[model samples]
Target: MAKSTTQNIRQIITKRFNGFFVIMLGAFGLLLFFLFKVVFVDGPTLKADASSKYLKERSIEAVRGNIYASDGSLLATSLPKYRLGMDFSVFKTSKMRDVFQKNMRPLAEHLSAFYKDRTADEYYYKLKSGFEQRKPYVLINMRLLDFQERKTVLTFPVFKLHPKNPIKTGVVFDKVNVRYAPFGQTAYRTVGYMKDKVRVGLEGAFDKELAGVPGHGIFEKMDKNMWRPLDGNKEILPQRGLDLHTTLDVDIQDIVELALMKSLDAYKGNYATAIVMETATGEIKAISNLMKNEKSPTGYSEFVNYAIEVSENDPGSVFKLPAMMAMLEESHMPLTATVTTGGKYTVYNKTMTDSHDYGTLTAQGVIEHSSNIGTIKLMQRVFGSKPSKWYDYLRNFHMLDPLDFQIKPVTGKPNFNVPAKWDALTYMWTSVGYSSNTSPLHLLSFYNAIANNGYWVQPIIVKNATKGNEVVIDYTQTQKRDSKPICSKETLDKIRIMLKGVVESGTGNNLKGTPYGIAGKTGTAQRRVNGNYIKGTYYVSFIGYFPVNNPKYTMLVAMDKPLGSSEGTYARQVTAPVFKDISDHIYARDMKIQRKLSGYLPDSLNNASLHHLIHPLDHSILYANLGFPRIEEDGRWLSFQLNKKEVKNYGLSFAPKKVANVVGMNLRDALFVLENQGLKVRAQGLGFVQSQSIPAGFPIQKNALITIQLH
Candidate 1:
């Protein structure tokens, strides 16, 4: 009787549980149906409504900081740029339609003339189409305009303010900040950029300091789907980012860039890197890593920071300097120590030889001539029995350590293994700038230490910064030495002498006549491709300090795979000349360098240097600002010689119905001329156009494709 009662009670409980589950399932299904309706059926309408009128917390973008050169010239900065839009919906009204129709043609003509991007008929069609379709917001042009352009654009007929109904203007714009370098692409990599929320170069390195704290504000949606802060003022004011004061010298940077471009143009190399640093402080005055870009309007572009990226390069004979230091420090070899170098030596059945049979040479003679045979002979003579000791000396010079550079994480560190890993092949090859992968920056540091009295200072880019008051930051702490001594004073002096001898008499004699006395070494290493050395390809470099006695600056010029014969690809022939040109510019600009020269440099630039191919407007602006008389000239571009008094202009003429010659014109002027003719252009390279696919004076065609190459 008790079991029967229990079964009845369990049956009742099960029925209740089943009923509850059914009810929950129905309720969940209903809830899901409602969710589906909201998400799929009415999602767009709801989202539009939410974005159109909702009062919500919105972020106010903080103004990013500016980057200034050491001399306070603006290098990189954010400026307000606006994309123009037209509220064509206003033209739907009968009274507004009359005004728009009457003024639209004139407005289109004015815009066509002002922007030169489209024909008057096209603009009229765009405006007419947007109005007929009742577009709430119609983009006037895809191009962004500066503040001055914004003000100027309002003067157009349909865009100008109405006497009472200001809304009749039908003009609108969205504001955004654009990152620009005032000096064009100069120091582009160093100043850096942001794209798709990813930052690079100094911009990436100092993003936290440069990107200020953002603040929140209550915002309400306005007509045309735009949001406005609830109040005229922000609820929380955003702090502007701190400005960075960099060690870059704009003039020096220009000099370096131009010199490297010239070298790249002359050598037809795949790429090149040039760096100039302050000797004592290790401040980077100018750095350039230009690479070949067949697609660029200029044949070259700065896409990689080759200066610090990888030590993929073998130091070649440049490694001899460190070897010289090692031997001087530990081996105590005299400059007069002799070695028999018949140009070939073998270690572990692997042979090493020089370009020339350097017969027999003293220690100094070996370095001066860059004799590979002599170098190997001397190293063997000193540490041959225990070649492992050779590795110890290189390690002491910090050759084996990572640069840990500020700009980029260095890779392919000088491949120095522990003594246990030393072998005949490794020792022989490593002895002559092979086996170890070393970067231009790391290799430069070694030379910098010698110039800096043996104190190895880390190379730095930023000088200081400021936060609010002046809107700047003080990053201005002194750079501490990375190491106390690269070598003893005696060793430093001996190495310095040997390096000077390299410039004076060695393979680097291509730069022998430099008045300031360049103390550097030249290196030429056969480029290894696919793990094998190529027959004719090469990587060459020249690095050293100038004015040997004073040691004001240290520089490195490196190039890879320069074209032409093997004879023309040597470092002295291809790289050292560029070093000389840059140094000459520095010597001319710096008062201290001039003082050191005792009036050796000319007071003014010669006419050869002054001759320029530039847009006339550029010179006009420059002359106007400098209080010099402007030349009476009008053309797409101009060639001129700047003298103290009169301005000279090599005249230019263009036919309205022909493709304008843009070979000597800059990218800006070139685009202005070509695009105005309704041509579709694909431009590559940088600077003045070198060639145009469509010959000048070819009959202009609307929507014809044209390509221009620059260098």
Candidate 2:
């Protein structure tokens, strides 16, 4: 009975064990089927989902273009700056904690000594707390550090200890770009800026070219808050914008600005503007616009570009050029035609006046005297039969058109449209520059046209745009705007003659004794305030070119509401003197003008000594070669006095004349004198001597250095 019971138990155990094995096999088969389905059908979707969560897209900013002066000096550029911060998470480890605690005090003291902005105790506690809290980033300072400063900070106690090894001290830097002007406030407006998403000046106008195209890249998440750029197939390199070469002459611009500022300070004017342009090319060399600062009653600073923007009033007597041109072209009137003025004269209901009483004068004389009544009489006599002809002349001269400059913030346009209701006195007012509104630039363009022999070329502020060293856009190489001649050559010549007379004997007479001849007009007109003429407020202006026989530059200077005595309020007093000052300065400095003046000398002696005394042989050779009247002088030393008529000679009594007045001499002459006395010369600047380190008449030292300043 016991053997039978044992066999039955063994059979039952076998059956149960077999059943459990079958169930396990079925479960394994089901799992394999699901794995195959997922791998084939859902792989792409799952991978995309993972990428969406972990991948990042980043933008790479392109480098903006630079602005350069005509001579290739940097005007505006972008500089990269960095903000330094520390990652305190590295100090979380016990080892790092011990190291940090050991160096904490020294690091804090070093930072305090270097930055001098915070106490050591304060820095120590702040840094220690940041480390304890395991902060990722703690700012080193509120102020962003430059590259050199950042490099210097890397040498500090803790920062220098570990760079690649973040466990010692974690350092981080965020880069930023800032616009920098090497020449601050010099042509600031013309160089321009972007503010509140709006572009101003050249920056605004050529933004498309200046702002380079942006690029893109892909990055992958490496940690909870850290992202690293993918190794390959991730980045698009950004392109740099092209550079701009402007027509501005920095030296001339500075001179013009200083001269304008001086006049503004002297007259206490509301504002002043001056522009210098190349006569034939219409390239603007220098432009300055300054306004008196109300807060600082005696100081003046740059405000709006008054030369090309402000157009509230009719140009004063400067408009006389256009009126005179109209009469000369339309009426075929000779410049000799006469008009009489007795201080005041009337046209219809309006009475015009001259500053001084002139009984009768030629049309040329009328312009020279700047007589409103005389100018009106001539215009009426010429344009009375057909008034519209006068307006047509102005239109043809381009006085009614926009300058269409390439600069941003477009230049202001003049209003020369005919009135709906033409009155009898309309011609009279417009003839004397009282009815229409125009900017100083507009007036300058017209005068430049006259100097250009009646051909009107558009004024250009920028010359070209370049990428790297290659020129991408050259304004001069592009198709030039068609220049129209405003009048016959003969008429233009006559106008030029009259303009010269104005400088020689008329309104601009104060500029007559200038080193070079100037031909221009002086304008004085009452400025209108709130649509009413203000008695004391006036616009005084002088516009002309130098070396009258062969014009090279045309300039315009205008002062608004100049305050002072009557004489100071006149154009000759306020603006003419400024013009003279600038012209004299330019004549002394411009290499082209100097070369032209040098051409007056014989070619054989073109590089002759500029010393006070020349060798007698040189004098004879210069006179014989150039056909100048020769003077018989037996003296060992000869001095030359150059006049328009002849080069005369005066014998110098040489007896080691103790360095007489070398302060105002030219560099070459100063050097010649100083070196002749066995002294070494070291000079700064390019023009006449302004100051000397060694006093004149001091006993000379052998080969001693003498410093001289020129301007």
Q: What is the C-alpha RMSD of each candidate to the true structure, in Å?
A: 10.6, 12.0
CA lDDT, every prediction? 0.78, 0.77
lDDT (10s digit) by residue, model 1, range 1-711: 999999999999999999999999999999999999999999989997786567667888888988888877777889899888777767766877888889889999998987898999999999899878887667777688877678778777977746345456778777888886666567777788899987888888889888888888987654445655664755887888888888998768877887897789888888899999999888999999898776644456788788876656677889888887887887778888888888678777878878888788889989998888888777777767877877777766667777555666535365567778666667767777877677788888889988988988878888777864563544435555755687788888788889888877888777777667789998888887768878778899999898778899999999998998777788978998999999988987565654442444354543334555665445554555445445556644566666754567665768877998788765655665676576767776655689999999999865688999877
Residue 615 displacement (Å), model 1 = 15
| Model 2: residues with Cα > 4 Å off, grouped in runs | 1-58, 89-97, 113-117, 162-169, 218-233, 293-299, 478-480, 595-711
Lowest summed lDDT over 10 consecutive residues: which window, candidate 1? 600-609
As for model 1, its CA RMSD to the true structure in angstroms is 10.6
- Scored by lDDT, the top model is 1
Candidate 2 per-residue lDDT over residues 314-391, each given as its tens digit: 688998989998888887788888888788886676778777898899999989999888888887788888888888
Each prediction's TM-score versus the true structure = 0.74, 0.74
Residue ranges of candidate 1 with Cα displaced over 4 Å: 1-56, 86-142, 162-170, 219-234, 294-297, 385-389, 410-415, 468-473, 476-478, 595-711
